[model samples]
Target: MTVTQILAAPAAHTAGTAGPVRGRRRALRRALWGAQILIAAFLLFASALPKFAGQADAVETFTRIGWGQWFRYVTGTVEAAGAIGLVVPRLAGFAATALIGLLGGAVLTHLLVLDAAWALFPAALAAVCALVGWDRRAETRDLLRSVAGLPRR
Candidate 1:
């Protein structure tokens, strides 16, 4: 009936048994975040590092793609950046979205230029990135809006 009561209604409604559900949701989110970080780290070390170092396999792969060694460094840099961004809470979704593109390129390279069998790894990584980005859609939207200098809703 009162202005104060009206304004406080929503908070009051959440002040009771909603605690357990909220706790569970928080736990689930934490678990998913942990998994996301682990995957990003794995990609950083397993794939990105070798590319940056110009390891034989990476050089050969890039050569097969007809892009030369320079492109290896570029892809490695992007992957490294994305991996770092993945650990930052505000940047996770954006990073995952970027990684999706990078990994998609890998997939295309495998399918078009290299052996199709080699495409599996990048395809899986891309799928995981897609899931991460979808799960953090709100964060992605916020980051995009901020980058575009648009007013937030």
Candidate 2:
């Protein structure tokens, strides 16, 4: 092949591949957002609301935990905040990381204090949060650096 044609070949190939790569990234981003929304809704409506409203099952469960009704409120608030954070672009990574810890505690509580079967839900949620956290690690790092008064890496 001519020198000019050889030089142009890689550029053409790269340009051809770029469109598909960009499309795949966009699709993946949309899927992640969709998952985040669904999980956030579940946390807010199914988990947090019951605690805030003092639903019978929630009260009974917290009573069994021996942490008092006050602890229920605290847990509810955290869940609600995390749910809100998940939808906020800047806070999504941090929120997911926080939720992973919260969900980890939940998994332990279910295994130890509640039914072992109940641990599965939180474990699944934690896995999703881990995905989001991994995807947004760069943003998380930037946020932490800003909080620490360190310049961006």
Candidate 3:
């Protein structure tokens, strides 16, 4: 083979290979975004709304935990805000990370104060948030780096 042909071969092969890889990455990113939105929406409607509306169960649950009804409103606001943040592409990772913390608290509350079996729902939500956070680690890192005034890698 000619020297020029040999030199160009790998470049040609790589160019051909990159397209499918990029396509798959795009699809995976979209899927992760969808999952984040779904989980966030679930948190907003099922948990946050009830708490904000002063639903009996939410009130009772907080009362059972020995925290005041005020705490319920605060928690509801945080969850609602985080849910909205998750819908923003640039903030999704951060939002997911925050939700993971919120869910972690829920998990601990269930295991420590409430029925241990009740922890499963929060645990599952935390796992999903972790997944989304992991999938968006690059964006998360970039955001943190920017916040810290560090140069992007």
lDDT of each prediction vs. the true structure?
0.78, 0.86, 0.81
| Candidate 3 lDDT by residue in tens digits, 15-57 | 4666654455555567777887888788799989999998999
* Candidate 1: tens digits of C-alpha lDDT, residues 1-153: 442332233322534646654455445457668878887788799889999887899899888888678998998889889989888988998898889999899898888989899899889878777767766767778888999999876
Q: Give the poorly placed runs of model 3, Cα more than 4 Å off.
A: 1-24
1 versus 3: better TM-score goes to: 3
Query: 1 or 2: which has the higher lDDT?
Result: 2
Which tens-of-lDDT digit does each residue in 77-151 have in candidate 2? 999999999999888989999999999999999999999998999999999998787776767888999999999
Please report how far candidate 2 places residue 5 from its true position, in Å.
32
Lowest lDDT block of 10, candidate 3: 3-12
Q: How many residue pairs clash in each candidate?
A: 0, 0, 0
Better of 1 and 2 by TM-score: 2
